[model samples]
Target: MDRYIPPVGRWKLARRTQQMTHSALRELLKVAERPDMISFAGGLPSPDALPLARVAEVTQRILHAEAIGALQYGPSEGYMPLREAIAERFTRNGSPVRASQVLITTGSQQALDLVARVLIDQGSRVLVETPTYLGAVQAFSQYEPSFEQLASDADGLIPELLSPAQLHDVRLLYTQPNFQNPTGRRLPLDRRRQLAQLALETGLLVLEDDPYGDLVYEGGPLPPIHSMAPDAVVYLGSFSKILAPGLRVGYLVAPEALMIKLVQAKQASDLHTAGLTQRIAHQLFTEGFLEPHLHALRARYREQCKVMLTSLGLHMPLGVTWTRPEGGMFLWVTLPPQLNALDLFDAAMQAGVAFVPGAAFYAVEPRHNTLRLSFTTSTPEQIRRGIETLGRLVTARLSGLS
Candidate 1:
């Protein structure tokens, strides 16, 4: 008898399912997971930074003391205590974030998805940065909104080019102002103000996705654009970086009017974020597990960043420029125009190193010579070795060695 393998591709599938493509970063991540590979690829917080003992302690406390509340189904808007905790933290900037405005989600990624579902219609205009976070692009693309990238530089997004004509029919403007993914560019104080003003003048809804705002190394925190233009912006915050990503705790603050629609969307999506994690996260937040933990994370990531920077300086060929971020896990690299980072990917793996090509982050035209390196996971020694391997590969490519 013939084997019973079915023709899976012949089955009818939804247009949306057919349209969806796999994430290149995820594909690369599989390769990076090998024991032999030293990956400067994933935007993973260091294991050393994760407060495992404290997390276990919190989990024990929640399970023992508030077992019913922790395990039960939660409101679609989120756990009230966690929401309150998030709202209080928002006041750190003195912008007066209220608990009423906060809505907890599974993750900030879900917040993006909910906002896109609520606000975007097919072909709606959505403004984004030139090299935005791939996750955002992936999340928003499902809603079929048209994307327009605003002009940007080392100082971050420039909304100066946001003319009145372009603002017509624009639904949302997405940005990662502090230590952006792939690029790691922090928007200056002036540009943040400019974006807020632009939103006020044109009524462009700003999605200020901030997962790394508190990880600043050199300077004090800049107020989020949502604070500057509360009515005009939707603020996203995540505990993924500061706390364990496994907790998947994230929240958003939007206008109450908009929050109603978002809550409806959240209800249809997954009912709500998990109750137990929210309770544990809230306990951690209120009991002061964050401050000392955050300090340790900053110290560890700072050292790793320093190692990568030094390695790049010593080994990379001249004209291969990279961003020097003040904080965060990632740094962007722009190779000389002649060398395409995509072409170098396989070679990098063969040489026992991995990186994310920059083109994957773009919503429109992509620069072929750019790539992103994540420094937080790898140790100083591994970073040195990985950079040396990558440098040699790049050099060989430059010299016409296949």
Candidate 2:
């Protein structure tokens, strides 16, 4: 008989791409389940904002009436009614997208992965903001692309930092233009136009991920970059933030040429987003239920944001800087250069609070001094208590070290 030996460890048998691993955010999800933990680690939408009762009602209606359509295999592009709804939204917002240009994805996360599959190849040069959405970075990493970090400020990406030579080889530029994750920085309208112009002039593709656009707490709305350079940008939007994450409905608006490729990639990935979910999303929209719901959500989130900002102002240690976003789930915090966020994470946890270290958001070597705090999931009281605890921990750490 052959020696009793396993063929190989799954990790060893896995493709080199598997070595990349999932995001730190996913890892934090495990910690978030601890009832004792006050987590600012995940970009979770508030449970109060989710239209749970509305979803249950619509879901029952769909099963009772259109069960066949809801359960049967659907088109890979998306459910037709859902696509039309998404297109109408874009048009109403002034982007004027066609339903044919939309491809429904399992989630905006899936949209990111599909774009990576279709556009990124080995050694493809991709440009990203220094501190960007970690999920996008992880999704694009599997393609083995070479990432170049773009410098950014509170106003968003620095267009001047983009060089002509860099543009020549860049396969894509990825940005979270509206209330960017981690940073909570919105790109100014002028910078958005400049980014569009650069992409158009250089023939570079832009992946504009705007999941947080609709969650604005207190700012004037700005047009999407795709609206300015429709031909050159691939825009990703999601119902996860405004509607509900459980539906997992998101969409990509791409040029017709690119849309075809993405649809094929999406088919290979998961066929299409669930028809039942799409139908439910359509029902919610068609019945005119989301507008007032969104208004309520904005009000609640704005209150939470204010709580966190006020707490930070009162408790944050000296030599720290943070962004005050007009609308969005998160705020980026930069600690003294001598401090490492990763090392401080445990201390914060011990103090009954948790947040994501900002280093994981970078594709290159990370900044050890930065961290991200989200205000959406926690209660206003929790935000205040958590920040106070975090401040105490920081003060203790600095005092002990000094």
Candidate 3:
């Protein structure tokens, strides 16, 4: 008898399940968790910056003050007070954002999935930044859209190549214009305007993901593309960076008509984001905890970034170059053509450091010579040690010594 035929063998998974591959970054982050390894792999915000004491206070206050409201099931559109608070944030920033246009999500990731579910048919054309957010790529892939790479430079996405002809039949353009992950590049004012102009001209929709916008170290906020072309954009924001990520609250701003469909999509997914967390977030924002907490976080990341940058400059061999990020937790590094980041992973982990290879960020034409380093998780001393270890390893590889 053939070994008992498992019932699961007869059960085929969805095509999307077949398409899903393990996240290299997630696996690397786990390797980074070893006690002795100094990891620059994860995009985690600094743990010290989490307002634990305040969270404790707020937890007590919310439960004692509004237990019934916190525990109850909420609307698919999100808790009403949080929706109003988010809308007010947009209004205060010079955009006319109405509460009616907002939809709260489990996280901004859910927003991405909802957009893909409601808007994308299989094989629909979608424009994405070259080396875009890995999570966005994963979320959007469920619908199996044909992805087109938008060229990017130091200033971020290049709108010139994305002319009207290129955009015909394009379902949506996904981008992270501020402190973009994996690369830590931000769009300048001119590029932002050009992107908005191109989208408006072609009547294309833009999914603007901005989880790291507030992580800008020292500068005024860059006006979101949605602000410039409100009707043509869906904007996503998250509290994971400023506040604790464990809360799992994020939202999307889109036109009301579009939002109705997205809310329905969301209803099918999770019914709603957690009511307790949403209400707690609303309370925190109303009490003005975000701005001040963000200032302290920026300062911490700025100093950590400085240490990492300085260490890289001091130790990294020639043929290795890295981004000097103005804000955000990460910087991108490019090694020589001969040194492949994916190939170097084992050596890196063995040498007491771990990082995400840059190949995972690209939708097409992945660069094997590149990698990303996150600066927020380590102490300045740990950063120095980690960079030095990495530098020594690269030098050895280039010299054929290890």
Candidate 4:
């Protein structure tokens, strides 16, 4: 046994591998699975929302009629029919996207990786919201770009705060304008316009990630920044939210010049998205299953959001505040400055309630007195119970401070 030990250190991993860290949300997902735990940790869609029967039908039909295509190696740019379907949907949503401009990737996460690889150099200045999506930070970090946090508030990132000085040397600005993760803040219409204008003026390439755009609960869809500045923005879309995450199908639209490079990067990465999944996703789009499914998802999630809001209002101690998002799976909770969310995690876990601490969402300086609550997966009763438990812990902390 002793002789069997290999020279592990001699293997010599890449520098980027050293920089890669496990996602905090993914780590917390283990706690979320405990039978006794009421988890608001992962941004997971409800099991009820998954169109299982429909998916089965689509999969069977594709295998029967197009088995060869489904099983064979697909184009790196993706199945042309699926790409065209996504492009048409984007065009209907106010952004005029073309199939030629779309490049299908394994997932939106891969799209993020490709964008980072193409645009970022070592020490390139990349701008992000004050507390941005942790996944974006993780993806972009591997490229060794310098991250700069933009000023933000409850409404979301402020276009007004992006001064000329801040714009200097900024290679990319990543934003999730609609129903953003962690905070669940939708950038307002005016802010979207201003941001689009700023990107155009500064020649900044904006990566607009809009996986949750179709989850609107309270209002009509606002024009995407990509629509406002098509040339300056790269848009990422996914079926993971509206369809199913397991399919791992997502697409990105960029300027033709940029699309060429992205397609090359994708080819090197995975060749193409899974062929069977691409065929299944295309049917889900063209066979008329997506629209009604979105309606049902909106209604269900809207109700879940309401219940969580009510629970927070009823149970949270004074000085604890949370965002009331119009649409999205998650919301941000800011605890009293004296109480750190990270410090509260173990106790909350012990009490069978789980939520992600907010500091993980930040790209630069993190605010310790905050956390994120995902409302889409848990039931109304579970939400109330978990929030009550969390509230009690927070009260005890506040009492200790007093």
Candidate 5:
């Protein structure tokens, strides 16, 4: 008999599928899993920080008392109690939000996907920081928007640099103002106000993705840009960073008018975030377990950040530079101009250290002379060893040694 052919060869993929490529960071995560490797690549919370006991108790209580509803299909908007709880928290934080305005998602990543689906069209202008979150870029790219790189400095996005032309025909400004991913740069309060005012003046919508807002290790968190102009900014929050990421629970708060569309998009995406996980998150938030847990988490991450900073200071070459992040898991590193981070990856891998290169974080005009290191997952000793290994590689490269 003739060889049988599979129909997969004849199937045509959607144009959006072409934009979906494997995440460079995720690929590094595989290498990170090897026991001998010291990885600063993945943006992971410390395993020690997970509230295993509390989560176990809560999950057991729910399953014992409300098993049927918890396991059943849920409303597309989300579990109502959790939505109310989240609304109350945001309102207390200075952003007055209504429960009706909240839409729970599979994860904050799903929230990003939903926002892109509802807002972006082919050729839409999307403003993003120079080295923005790669995950957001990945989510937004599928919709085929034209990304405009906003100018940023060491501290993060410069709101003053936003010109009138940049706002013209812009669909949304996606930002992680609080301890932004890859760079670990937080926007100052003054800039937050400026950004809010700019959005209001230009009638631009801002997507404030604040997964790391609660991870503050120094000083305090500035009021969110969403709080400054509640109607103009769509805010996304997550339990992943502070709590466990395995649950895949997150939410977005939008003005009620726009929220309806987001809810519809979410329904089309996934009926709702899992009721069980939503309930678990809500119970943790309302029962007063989350705050103390966060306190412990902040202290743990603070020490990790300190260790990484101290190690980098002691070992890195004279021309090498890195951000001193007050909070958050990752920090950006700029190698000497002569050294390219991508070129050093293989050697670093062989040397048993792994980090995400800065080029993967960019939407356009990637800088090969940079990389990102996450401090949360590794121990202080591992961080010191990893940085020492990386610094040696960088030094050798600058000296024209392989």
Candidate 6:
């Protein structure tokens, strides 16, 4: 019997850009959901760190007092009060920015997307750190920019390495600048100034995504690059790490010229982020709840970082290099060149631990020998167990390679 199949017409599909799909770090979190798997893959703030009680209280107040405003659609630029609060936060951090400069986004992820949409044309040249935030790359990739990876080290992006030739046609330079994701490297004060100077000299635009700055475990916070070269840098900040990620609240600070364009782009994107979420975030900030809350986050993450560091010292093989981050959710580990981290991932997963292969974080020519291990989500005991398992896997692989 012949089976009747539907006739296939020419497939109407997405553009070349849309055809590419990138997986999120959260997808690898499936391992943690299994109860048996200990995850070192999630770039998450500690669950215990979220100000749930405060959020619940503030949310209840917002719903009861301003039901219509909370539930109804908000201005494309965001609720004014929240923008003011965000602006004040920036000023308090030594970056004197106005509320008009702040464009509330669903998350910093949205800020990155909107910036990409507004600034990037097809095939526009863009500069990124050697191993930067995978999410930023995913967001920017939709615009089809030609990514030029700049070399970096423990201090973050090397300013001297960014040549004038690289700046010629580059539309934007994307950087985390503080407690960078995947690598957990912070750009030092000197380098931060140098970068600002370079941007000023070369006329390059900078997109500064800083979600983890408030969670600094040690050292005084440096002024944002935007503070030095306000016109050249587009600053992205988030309440996710300090307050709660579920709120999905973040903001972008751009020069008036750039923000005007981004506001139109954002309005067309999501109408606006949920009004209730913005209201709740504003209430928390205005009611003076964030400072102590941030303190708690710092303390907890510091202890967790220590746990992971101790575990690594005890378990990791000699000659393996790993970053010792002052603050943030991750540490980047570079294995011996003979060992391919992607090849080792399955063995680590089978042994009940999971981490992100660093190759995925690179925009081009992935470094197969590196991987990112997150320490924020797992417990100390789980960290110890997972690292021990990972260490054994590495030992066996290295031995076989030898």
Off by over 4 Å in 3: 1-7
Sequence-dependent TM-score of model 5: 0.97
Candidate 4 structure quality by residue, lDDT tens digits, 1-402 = 222333457684566675689998888897777878898998888989999999998888888998998999979999999899888888987888899999988889999999998999989999999799999999999888999998899988999988878898888999999989989999999999999999889898899999999999998888889999999999998989998999999999999999888989998899999999988888888887788989999999999999999999999988999999999898999998888998899899888888999999998889999999999889999999999999899999899989
Q: How do the residues 205-274 of candidate 3 rate in per-residue lDDT, one tens digit apiece?
A: 9999999988887566789999999999999999888888899999999998898899899999999899
User: For model 1, how does the per-residue alpha-carbon lDDT over 35-56 read when each residue is reduced to its tens digit?
Assistant: 8889899998888778888889
CA lDDT, every prediction? 0.88, 0.89, 0.88, 0.91, 0.91, 0.87
Better of 5 and 6 by TM-score: 5
Q: Stretches of candidate 5 above 4 Å error? A: 1-8
RMSD to native for every prediction? 4.0, 3.3, 3.2, 3.5, 3.6, 4.0
Clashes of 5: 0
Candidate 6 worst ten-residue window by lDDT: 1-10
For candidate 1, the 10 contiguous residues with the lowest summed lDDT are 1-10
Q: Candidate 4: lDDT of 52?
A: 96
Count clashing residue pairs per candidate.
0, 0, 0, 0, 0, 0
lDDT per residue (tens digit) for residues 230-343 in model 6: 889999999887788899999999999988899999989998999999998899888878888878878878888898889889988987889999988889999999889988
- Predicted structure 2: clash tally: 0
Task: Tell me the spans in candidate 1 whose CA falls farther than 4 Å from its real position.
Answer: 1-11
Off by over 4 Å in 2: 1-7, 10-14
What shift in Å separates residue 345 of candidate 2 from its native position after superposition? 0.8
Candidate 5 RMSD to the correct structure: 3.6
Return the clash pairs for model 2, or none.
Answer: none
